[model samples]
Target: MYCEITYQTTGERWGIFPRDIGEFQARMSIPDSINSGDSHDTIVKKSVKIEIMSCSFTPDEKNKRHREALEGLVDRLVKAGWEQMTERGAEWYNIKFHKEMQK
Candidate 1:
């Protein structure tokens, strides 16, 4: 099984590939540095999409289940204020607010 996790942030769209649903879930559950209270930012808001592909399931029922799981995770993250950021946006944010972000 292959899972593609897409994160659409303020100005960036990032894609993460997880080997399976378990890995995807695990990654989603882990908090980033900003969310862990190590950074000044309160929340990182991001829109998420998960795409799953499985060869075993003929009808691909597993994909639906995976999508549901991903949706749940995304909802949780959004509620927590995890905003998405594009690469250029991130760079600009970093450069524009490097001093604040560094703290």
Candidate 2:
């Protein structure tokens, strides 16, 4: 198992967080890694490609900022233990990341 973002904020906690602003999300803290028997951080995050939950992309500054912020947030999440996952080698690319799959 990889590191889990057990670290939380004051208002509320979730397995997920709001992906609106990068700085806002940055204010939050992730759980500190635990030491393994070897006296080192025992956990790591999986390398997965995750994208924002937006329905569409706009060619504007705000959209650009949001996208960049989201990317940064993903990196932070990975570092903090919110590891990424893939089934058919597809990257996670939406807010409803865990939706019903087609049979």
Best by TM-score: 1
lDDT of 1: 0.32
Alpha-carbon RMSD of each model: 13.6, 14.0
TM-score of each: 0.30, 0.27
Q: Which pairs of residues collide in model 2?
A: 7-31, 53-95
List, residue by residue over 1-103, the lDDT tens digit for candidate 1. 1112333212222356322222222122223556574323332322243333332211132456545654565565545444433322221112111111222
Model 1 residue 12 CA deviation (Å) reads: 35
lDDT of 2 by residue, 1-103 (tens): 3222211122322235432211212222233447333332332222222233322221122546445644665576555545354431221222111212235
Model 2: residues with Cα > 4 Å off, grouped in runs: 1-62, 87-103
The residue-level lDDT of candidate 2 at 25 comes to 29
